[model samples]
Target: MRNPLSDTIVNIPPSGIRKFFDVVSEMKGAISLGVGEPDFDTPWHIREEGIYSLEKGRTFYTSNSGLKELRQEICHYLKRRQRLEYDPNTEVMVTVGGSEAIDIALRAMLNPGDEVLIPQPSYVSYVPCTVLAGGTPVIIELEEKDEFRLTPEKLLEKITPKTKVLILPFPNNPTGAIMNRTDLEAIAKVIEEKDLFVLSDEIYSELTYSGKHVSIAEISGMRDRTVLINGFSKAYAMTGWRLGYAAAPALILKQMLKIHQFAIMCAPTTSQYAAVDALRNGDEDIARMKKAYDERRRYLLREFRALGMDCFEPYGAFYMFPCIKRFGMTSDEFANRLLQEEKLALVPGTAFGNCGEGYLRVSYAYSLEDLQKAIERIKRFVARLDGEKKC
Candidate 1:
């Protein structure tokens, strides 16, 4: 038999976040802060909407683009939340999740050998998606000092003639970083001058601890060149709803929709109906959950700092990237030893990218009680490491 896999697919490693999550799953009495999922249930109103759709016998596939109502609501959301306008009829698309939008956006944009500028310590899917799209992944290593926001200088250093797209994974995943408007303006200037398109993943937009989350599409001259991706998973606790959206220029979106229909046909009928409700009546639910997450974020930051852990202030997302360097152990080693000795599971930093060494991604999506328990275990585990260091 011939080799069963394409070389491109074969070389890509599985998600680093899931490794510790799998181990902790089988271990007894384990406390996992690994997965970046919300602790809240899908808000009652949103779930009820899905049930109503099913009760009404609306369980068929939506259009290739998605339910017209949902797409319109998505556009309203962009307009109302981000001060940006999109045409639901031609410029918006509903996807399986933000992950799908990322994949297809790359597929729709890149040709053979196109270079994509991807900053490291970002969400895990960007590099693999670029490769699968036949684009070369050029990594821009974000600095801790920069709070993981992409700088124009860093972006300029990596761009080549082949560079076609830049991925803006702000309100970032593992590091919990966000690029303020000024930071984005500088990046916008570079992208516009270089004539690059961008994939701005703003799935965590609603979960920001700072002020309102700004989209790069809001930048002058950027609306036409940016694909703005977002979803209900982080904001409305709708992760299992398996829904997300992208707002792009009509020309680009037309191509993306073609791929979406051939591959997926449409998003779930029930999810789309429910998402319409989420957009229309779920602002309060988002405010409630975001409040809880912010509390948890502050609590974790305080606790970690009190323990003398070195972590910069992360203004967005629910994850914290804390430096584990003082313990003189690799992030994987530290995470593994904590799991083995204390049955606590947190993902290793190196799982994100090579530059993520000496750090660990800690999620605040768990409850305060669970977080407190996890902290007790971490406190004990690190004390042991402190003792070992003395020896």
Candidate 2:
């Protein structure tokens, strides 16, 4: 028998974040600041909606694009939250999660050997999804000095004739960098000039700590060229529900739906029903959770600074990217040694991209109590390292 495996599938490395998460899961009394999931459970009202759907025997599959009501609610939510408009009938489709939407979008858009400009350190899925879609992954190494925001200069430098998709992963993972309107307008100018499309992953949009989250899709001349990806996972703590959606021009959405229809049929029905409730009535829930996350974010920033580490003050999402270069070790080495010696798990920044090598992504998604304990352990580890250096 031939040893048969497609090089594309085999060559893709496993998620770097999950490797550490799994190790921490098996260890007794381990505190993980690694996983990006919200520590809060799904808001009760949203869960009640899912339960209500089940009770009413609404378990049948939705249309390939998803339940009409749910899609309308998604469109409404996007409009209310981000000032972006979409037609539920033709522009929106529910997905399993933001992950599935991302995969299908790439598949629908990429021609073989097309180049996708991905900025790092970003969410882990972008590179692999682009690769599996038969696209070339062109990485833009986002710099710490810029707070990890992707500049228009960097964007222009990476563009070429083959560049087809620019992945905008703002309120960025690993690094909690966000692009405000001015920042986005600069990039949009380039995209319009170059005739490129954008896949804007705004999964963390609702988690922004600063002013309201801005969508590049809302910029002039951008809506037709942007596929906006967002979901309830971060804001409503609905990660387990596995519901997300993509909104784009009808033409792009039609192609994406074809792939989704054949591959996934539709997102889970119960999840979609619950998501409708989430969108329609979950604003207060978002404010409540965002407040909690903000408290944790500030606490972590203060603690990290007090511990004598250089941490970027994250204005979005629930993670902080702290520079660990002072420790004179690679991100992996610091993370592994901290986990082994202190029973605290932090993801190495390199997990996101090589640009993350000197940093560590510490999620503040845990409770203040857990974060306090983790900080204590981390401080002890750092102190020990400093003492050794002095010796």
Candidate 3:
């Protein structure tokens, strides 16, 4: 007997983030700050719309491009929030989630051996999707000193003849960093200079605290070259709903639609109907959730500092990437011991990339009660480690 799996997948290890998540899942009484999803329900109105659609027997498969009304809503949301315009009919395609949109976009754009510039530590899917699509993932390690943002100088240094696209993951994951307009414009200058296409993942755009979210597509000359990937996951708390959309140049969108047409057929019809409600009537929910996350963000930053971990105050997203290098333990070892000793689960920095090595990503998506418990647990864990060191 012989193994029949493809070498590309067989050689690759499982997702580092998921490895701990699987361990945590089977444990009793474990509070998970490990996942990047919100704890809220998808608002009453959004739920009602899905229910209403089902009641009306609107369960048939929708057009491959998704519901027209939902796309229009997405168009309005993008323009109203980030000042990016897209013709909903030709330039947009609704995918199962931002994850699927990411996959399809890479497949539609990159030829074999094409290189895509990705900034770390980013969402985990970009590098894997690039490889699966036969493209090379050229990771640019974002610096902690620069608030973990991808600077133009760093980007420019990474590009070569094979660089086909750049994947912009901000407001970023794990690091909870955001790029303001000035930061975006500086990179926009390089994008124009290089004539590179971009996959801008702005799923956490609504979760920014310090400044307004600026889309690269809003910059001049970028609208045509940038493929905007956003969805109802983060801001609307619709993660399990599996609803996300992509906006791109008509030609690029058409090609992506073909992939979606074949691979997914269409996004879930009920979710599409519910997403319209989320777009039209979920602003208050977004505001409420953002407020809670902001409060948690501030509290966690204060706690991390008090606990002796050097933390960069996150301005966006619901995670805090605090440097635990002072503890003199590798991120993975610390994370595992913390879980075993104190029953707390956190993603190790190296899960995101090598640049993430000395830190730990702590998600603030739990309730204040849960967060407080986690903090106490972590404090005791650190104290135990300190006592052991002194001994």
Candidate 4:
């Protein structure tokens, strides 16, 4: 049989986080802090709306652009929360999730060999999606000393004549680093000078603990240049609902909808109804969940530091990335050893990028009881390593 995979298919690596997660599954009493998902179930109101849709037999496909009402709600939500405006009819498109929105946007915008500036220690999907869309990913390292932020200087250095898009993964995954208005304005200046487009993943926008979330689209000229990507997954505990949407320039959204029309037809009709409710009636639920996560986030950061791992205080999201260099083991080695010896699972930071070396990403989405247990076990594991002088 001839090998059937395309060149693009053959080149992509599997998700690095899944490796430890899979191994941890078979272990007894394994405490996992590796999941990048909210611990809460979708709120009753949201779930009730989805069930109501089903009872009404509204399972038919929506337009490829999704329910107009949902898009309008998204526009309101964005404007109210982030102060970024978009015309719901022309500028917004509902997607299966932020993942599909990302894939479709990249496909619609890029041609073969166009360079995409991606910051390292970001979510894993961006690079692969760029490649699949026939774009080249140029990675810029975001250092811990800089609070894992992508600087304008670093972004400027990576841009070339071929550069087509910049992926800004903020309120960042794995690292939980966020950009304030000052940081964003600096980045906007560079993008304006370079005439670059932006794919801003703001899925964690509502999860910030230290400050209010600021969207790059809020900047004067950047609104038209930025594609705002967000989802019900993180903020509303709707990960399993698989609902997301994008706010983009009308022209780009039109192109993206064409691709979406051919490939996906529409996002789930039932989920769309639920998402409308989520966007409109779910603020209390969001606030409640954010409070719980903030508590857990603080606890885990303290636990990790007390265990002698040097870590950055995450400002948003539910993860902590702590440098593991003192243990003298690569992230992969340390992660594997922790899983095997302590039966605790966390994602190695290297899974995000090479710049993520010497760190491990621990998610605090688990309950306080579970997190406390995992921390104690991890502390003992580290102490044993010291006793054996194995670090």
Candidate 5:
């Protein structure tokens, strides 16, 4: 009856993106360009594998690290795509989505007051998870001019003697930004020289619109010090499958698996079986979905620019961070008005971090038809704002 909650947990804020989503859910005839989910179904082949697993009654638990087959497939997939190698037996572990991999990795590594350098306008889970892991979250604000990438200079500015980890959220979420090889090499040099470890969240690796996605773990000296996290959710339209993985050095993985062993037991057996199929046969599915997403991304950029809205052309992820500063409203205010007046929902950029002020994260994962409808509404809404500015 005394203190019901820990002060630490009580002080953390809820996700800012959910507020608009909850409102849009109840509003009639609302169109949402908010949620970062694929419009496509889990490809028929992938779904069939899950059905087959259930039909075969493979419903029991897999090993805590996951079905050996799925882990090995994950290793092969990474090697094929990223040129990275891992021992499936000791270096890989399946998790309950990338979120779990993130949580357990932080728990395995951090001690109280260990500073974690996190760049702004990144996935919301990083800061909260770092805090829960007993690490102090040091925010490094990424610049719009830098395309929301974490620059080496900016990263260096935040590092302290207590800095223990850097969370690299690239092919970034809200901003759709990606760090090319040169961009990464510069940052990797700093990390190596500073002797800092990394938590590279590459869940969107398969969704990049430009050249191939590069993992910081691919850097010469970094894999041993990096935990590479990825999953099928974004890549395979397998969100509900709840399967993800982490490939880390055996020493670090041993500790992470210990936490996962007690906390999660294992990822879903059916999902694991299906994921092996995905890793093996889903490359075509990924390419197909990415093609559609890129088309939508380009269409939205053209529409936003044609309306004279300032939006940077993003090269990765399915979200677009368009500046709403010209409308003279804060992101939350503009998004709120857009939802009320037009029944169109988008995530306020500030939902990711303070640096996202004056911007909105528009997801292109919705269909081209849905995107066209949403744009008509946005067009109308912005026209009125334009008229008001002139008056």
Candidate 6:
């Protein structure tokens, strides 16, 4: 048989974060901070809604765009929380997860060879999704000095006639970086000037420790060109439910819907029903979970500082990207050694992007107890490395 794989697919590297996660899974006593998943279970009310739907025999496929009630609830949630309004009937469509929304958005917008500006050290999906959609992936390396926030100047340097889409992954995954209204206004200016579209992945929108998350869709004139992707996973702790939605201009949404309708048919019915309840009555759950994550966030930062590690104070998401450059090892080496020597599993920063070479991404999504243990092990590991260097 001939070698028969799509070169594009073959060329895309596997998820770097998952590599260590798999290793940790097999180790008996490993404490993993590798994956980006929320550690909390779905709130009991939300879970009960799903159970209720199943008992009521609502195990049928919804409309290709998803359940009408769920879509409307999504619109309401976005408006109430982010101050961004959308026409649920035409502009919003639910998908399997935020990951699918991202893939389909790229497929809907990108023509062959169109250029997409991706800020580096972002969620792992953006670059590969762009490539698979037949778009050119143009990386804009974000600086740690700037807290990994994408700058308008960096945006300008990357734009060309072929530039079609910019992915704004805020409340960023590996780095926990965020862009405030003023920061987004600058980038919005550049996007508008360049006549580009945006795919704003605000999955961690609810996890910001600072001020509220500002969606680019909320920017003046940006809603028309932005596809806002969010979901129940991070905010509602419904990762297993796999429900997400995309809100964009109806014209763009129509094309995305075509791809989603053909590819996925519809999101799971029970999940949609649960998600409707989540959107309608889940604010308290969000507040409670956000408070927990915030506490863990502060604890990790203080612990990292006390251990003399160069950690950027993350104000969003559950991950901390701490610089491990001083140890004179690659991020991969540092992560591997820590795991081997101390059974602590953290992701290498380079798993996010090449620019992340000298850092490690430690997720604080674990419980405070687990975090405390991991920190103690990490402290010991670093001390040993320091002693070895002195020798």
Highest lDDT scorer: 5
**Candidate 6 stretches greater than 4 Å from native:** none
Model 3, stretches more than 4 Å misplaced? Answer: none
- Better-scoring candidate (lDDT), 1 or 5: 5
Evaluated at residue 275, the lDDT of candidate 6 is 94
Clashing pairs in 5: none
Give me the runs in candidate 1 sitting further than 4 Å from their true place. Answer: none
Candidate 4, residues 225-282: lDDT per residue as tens digits? 9889999999999999898999999989999999999999999999999999998999
In order, what lDDT does every prediction score? 0.92, 0.93, 0.91, 0.92, 0.93, 0.92
lDDT of 4: 0.92
> Taking the tens digit of each residue's C-alpha lDDT, what string does model 1 give over 147-200?
998999999999999999999998998999999999999999999999999999
Q: Which ten contiguous residues of candidate 3 have the minimum total lDDT?
A: 10-19
Every candidate's CA RMSD: 0.8, 0.8, 1.0, 1.1, 0.8, 0.8
Model 5 lDDT-worst window of ten: 16-25
Q: State residue 117's C-alpha deviation in candidate 2, in Å.
A: 0.2
Q: How far does residue 368 in candidate 2 sit from its true spot (Å)?
A: 0.4
lDDT of 1: 0.92
lDDT tens digits by residue: candidate 6, 1-391: 9989988889999999888777788999999988778889899999999999999999999999999999999888888888988999999999999999999999999999999999989889999999999999999999989999999888999999999999999989889999999999998988888899999999999989998999999999899999999998999999999999999999999999999988999999999999999989999999999999999989988988887889888899889999988889999899889999999999998988999999999888889999999989988998999899999
TM-score of 6: 0.99
lDDT of 5 at 44: 94
How do all models score by TM-score?
Answer: 0.99, 0.99, 0.98, 0.98, 0.99, 0.99
TM-score, prediction 5:
0.99
